[model samples]
Target: MRSPASLVLLALPFTLAVPAPAAGNLGSATTQNGLTAGGCKAMTVIFARGTTEQGNVGSLSGPPWFAAMSKAVGAQNLAVQGVDYPADIPGFLAGGDKKGSAKMAQLVMQAMTACPDTAVVMGGYSQGAQLVHNAAAMLPADMAAKVSSAVLFGDPMNGKPVAGVPAGKTKVICHQGDLICAGTSTILMPHLTYSQNAGEAAQFAATAAGM
Candidate 1:
């Protein structure tokens, strides 16, 4: 099994610039309703968005990184879902949000329950990554077993690893100079550049999802 550090290194070369999608393409209206609408799930990628003061869906709209990821996953005929949560600083600094994480975990468990044979791939960015890690770690063993892989970007908790995800099945992507991952760049550009890596990251997520 490759260590998480090794996976981050492997992701470095693919983290190049790509044209940004139109602002109109940010995400789908389906996000407003979240994942509970219920459909047969062959595969699903649950993404928790980064920090926001907005309600559930937040303001982190489409042309969003997860939308690109969903497109890639969809090419493989896999379904995709975005999780809506209070991804705020207060939630993170509190160590973890009992209500928010529990809600996230519940959605995950529901997905697992509804799609017993479906492979689940979960991921997040920045604080959202931390939330996914916390939620996945809190899942019942059987539910956790259903999750095939986790892909995280600019995870603030990179140094303090989460407990549930096995090293082999998790991939972390921190840009060369992204300060969030402890890189030296003093700018937020690195933190915001994940859209450039959408294609590569989605491909990685697909492989992790066993497609």
Candidate 2:
């Protein structure tokens, strides 16, 4: 358990930055072409941003996660992509953006097919985590097997396992007081600081990817 002092410290950033900045802080709005055009790297991360967050990959968790992952396994080996989808609140209310989730699944297939040997890491934060779950559900069992690891933060569907992906390959990180993980829509202090978990998530992804 985190001490009270730690809790206060974690809450500071969110307290000041109520609505975080856009993808420019971390990534861009689209990577549909980026991944397909570049061929393949040693690894690929297919990420989705949260509701109301700017760009395809939000500023909060995506950048920090990618940076840490690159450090864990050389940057030369890593290629990142964000699932382009309308990340509005309504989409989250509807159990993640259906089209967005489909797009994510499509991206996964593209990765597995184009570079079957490339290590694949799937991830998302908050509503993005919902996309991960929805996307995995769309993949065939054989295709899903190629995904090396998946990491979700502030997941609304916390208790459930990622569909078709083995339990061991997935890690859902929900802060102690995150209401979203409890199946509520209310955003709390815990949900906003998932970037702090980047290192731990990156290590898990790296180990799972065998990098």
Query: Largest TM-score belongs to which candidate?
Result: 2
| Tens-digit lDDT track of model 2 for 90-143 | 677788999999999999999988888888888998889999999999999998
Error of 1 at 66 (Å): 3.8
Pairs with steric clashes in candidate 2: 29-56
Where in model 2 is the C-alpha error above 4 Å? 1-34
How does candidate 1 fare on TM-score? Answer: 0.73
For each candidate, the alpha-carbon lDDT, in order, equals 0.60, 0.81
Question: What is the RMSD of candidate 1?
Answer: 8.2
Measured against the true structure, the TM-scores of the candidates, in listed sequence, are 0.73, 0.86
TM-score of 2: 0.86
- Candidate 1 lDDT over 66-133, as tens digits, reads 56665766634555566667665456555445566667687778778887767677767766677777
Q: Give RMSD to native, each candidate.
A: 8.2, 6.0
